[model samples]
Target: MLTNAVPTTNGPVVGVEQGAVRAFKGVPFAIARRFAKPVAPAAWTEPRHCTDYGAYAPQPGHLDLAIEESCLSLNVWAPAADHPLPVLFFIHGGAFVTGGGADYDGSFLAAHGPAVIVTINYRLGPLGFLQLHRHGFGEANNLAMSDALAGLDWVRANIANFGGDPDAITLSGQSAGASMVIALATLPQARGKFIRALALSAPGRNIMSADHADDVARRVLEELDLAGDAGAITSVPLPTLFAAVERVSRRLADETEAGTLFGPVLDGTVIPHEPREVFADGSLCDIPLWLGSCRDEMAMFLKSMPPAAMIRTTERQVRAAFGEAGWERLLSCYRATARVDEDPYEALLSDAFWHRPMSDLARVHATAGGAVWLSRFDHRPALEPFLSQGPTHGADNACLWAHLPNFIDRPILKRMGGPMTPEDIDVAARFQANVLRFVTAGVPDIAEAWPRFEPAKEPLAIFSQPFHVIPLNDGARFRAWAELTARPGAVA
Candidate 1:
């Protein structure tokens, strides 16, 4: 299935045609050594066949999967058209420990809009993010983010050959990937590489400080029986290190206040300060921003927790997220806003982790003269028979991408896809068009005058079957959160 060669800045690479799109998979964007910064990929004399996806970074719980250290590869999906088009660079979300670009297929977005779509893979877990400054590997703590920056750098220098506009780049991501996009927008090294960003459910408050990162590193080292030994850490088998990472991660999961298990640290080089601190300082990118979270951001994760424990955790997080004076008011608002009987905990998690931080960041970005467009994805298909939970995290992805729930596996999905309804197709089409419109013009072309978010007029574009705009603070819980967040020293 090899097609004509596309000449890049480094070398000429070849791709294969899949349906209406040309896919270039397993393309190396950078080369790296363990616990070292990435360097440019080696030059090749002949065209490199990039048809199959490369290896993913080694992670625990997936021992059967291939793993490697030099795993900074990316996949490109471009339309068959000859003219240049806009580019959408996506990063996958796996809580910064697992997941890779290969998990996603971007051909739908590529063919539908005739735009080039690039999904990249970065290092994960202990190998990528554990702080090692105390042990002398200070530069490698944020290798995952550095890998993403290298991928963006590759696109900036070489996307033109794939009929993509280098200047019209839109950085888009979900979950952990969304956080990376926000971090890139804040960092100086990644400035000017992207025109705008589309952040889908960014966990804006999970970044760890250097000290916390060091603590996690020490625990992992102790678990692996390599305490205070830099040589063993650098040379240990990945499986042994990954098992230790799992022990540390499982132990920290109970500490809800603890940040992500293995994620970007504010190491003073890559990520200068905490994300909240950066957003508060109004130093974010001044481009147009489109960001939002789902209605049930925690349902997927809370499935394992007992009802009483979940309720207790929600109650505790409420005060930390908001403040002391209005804890009762906030809980009352949450209970009143619960759409279902078992929804209060989901509501609490959504506000504390997703909506509240997103709103805060929107305010700061607007204050910095950036146009902010916010939304809430509340579309739950009637055909979701696998789980009763409504519109959980990453649910909007079904309508946004070609990988609709109907097209996926499971007995329920098969039956649903067997007879796709007009409403389903219509909704999917509308979302894809709006997303492409934003990618092309830097702002979503909706029916109404999509107002930019302000302190008073917190406008939001709600994406439903009938997409429309409403004040972000419309509901009781939202109003209460808006008031609580406006006060000094709110954590969310």
Candidate 2:
């Protein structure tokens, strides 16, 4: 069912699909940004062939990116229109700097359930972020968020022909992508525009202080060979700026233990408040959620470090990075909780970054009476650099892509030169099956009525060799982090 031109509410649309499994690319969901301004819908003259994706929105250094005007486009894959289906919108993560939606082929996830799968590319790094760009007469402060808003609005206005129920869209993302969901959901301008459910994997803090935005802008400017004080950087060649920002981001990611730093900022227009504050105040979209991090989140952070060093990292190190009382508190939790001292530093990395932030989000969401499902990935990928990568950030993608649990010695994927690995395929099927049921019915699969957080206790369903439950928030290890990093602020 490929058509060269189909009439849409916004404009005349022409799209093509390769096959039953993969179709719908280069669909224009919004007007293109021209000369620093997002224009109104421009009528099409020719039957715009949308079968192939349009030029990727300008990104820092992605190999496929072609800088062009027609970047506000999205690609979709869904069940044939013979039936109505839930919709899944994917946001790619690249530390808010790199990645294009075109990279993630959605045919795999489309098979998970009866839903339209959408993969997108949005403005990244200097182009999309840079709230401080508005200072001293910059074009826009929330460019990245504005682009995302346009994409979501497009989904809301026109997902029906693709056999997708726009009302049942579930927004999901990983890494920087995950953080984008958090920011958009918190932005009042985005309320009810698109998405009925939220799924964030390894989300970062979005609402930044003015100081934070200034620092980020300075960094970007400095990399452009201009004064970091924000002068003449924007005047530099766009491609040069993009390339320099990309290099500086890589260097900054290595400069700190915290990894990358590009993220959403509170610019008063698109972002009126901090996301953590929005979560605390219960203003976020009230919907079913699936949220959690991996067991060895720090594994990826320690990948370059000697495994021998990782195994022997001491409390002295943790304290130095954090503080004295904090280190001791976290150490107590690690030894008492995981029940394995195989790697002393494991707890250090877990508490400071993954465990604390993840649990805090879960607790706030659950406490707000939102239906939040918690999960912890304990599966270990130990085949190729598996131990170092562990079941880190994109572990869930294994389930989403190859349809397998975290592979131990096996690649978590079996016979992938074919369809998804049996295990991952099963997970992809079941994951969306339940979520679809929840989106349509308002109850996240009655049979899967997961547990809720109880005060200091955090419960997460484990998707591993055998499905089991693991107490996360209340676990001694997480509690140690809660104590160590506990602040009056909710940004954690």
Model 2 CA deviation exceeding 4 Å by range:
17-22, 31-37, 60-65, 81-83, 222-235, 246-260, 304-322, 332-342, 381-388, 403-429, 438-444, 447-449, 452-457, 482-492
Residue-wise C-alpha lDDT for candidate 2, range 1-492, written one tens digit per residue = 555455566566665554555467877665544224344457666666667766766664443446555677788876565777777787877667666666666665575465688877677667676655544635557677777777877777778866788777777777777778877777776777554554545643444565556666677766765663455654566678777766765665545433344577776766788776777776653766666566666665566543312222333345565566566666665555554434446646665555556666777876776667667766643333434566665565544544233332221112122333555545445555555555455544453445655445566767665556766645455455555555443222
The total number of steric clashes, by the backbone 3 Å criterion, in model 1 comes to 0
Candidate 1 lDDT over residue span 1-492, tens digit each? 887998887788999998989999999888887888889878987999999887776665554565565588899998866678999999888777777777677888888887899999888887778887677775767888999999999999999888898998999988888988888777779778988888898874546677888888878888888786765788787788888887786676566556346666788888876665665676664678888788777777677444323334555666776656678787677787676545775677677767777877888787766778888877664445314777777766656764543433222112233233566566667777878888987777743557668777888777767877787767777778778877888755
Sequence-dependent TM-score of model 2: 0.81
**Worst lDDT 10-window in candidate 1:** 409-418
| Shift of residue 137 alpha carbon in model 2, Å | 3.6
Q: Once superposed on the true structure, which residue ranges of model 1 sit more than 4 Å away at CA?
A: 274-285, 305-315, 320-328, 340-342, 382-387, 403-421, 447-449, 482-492
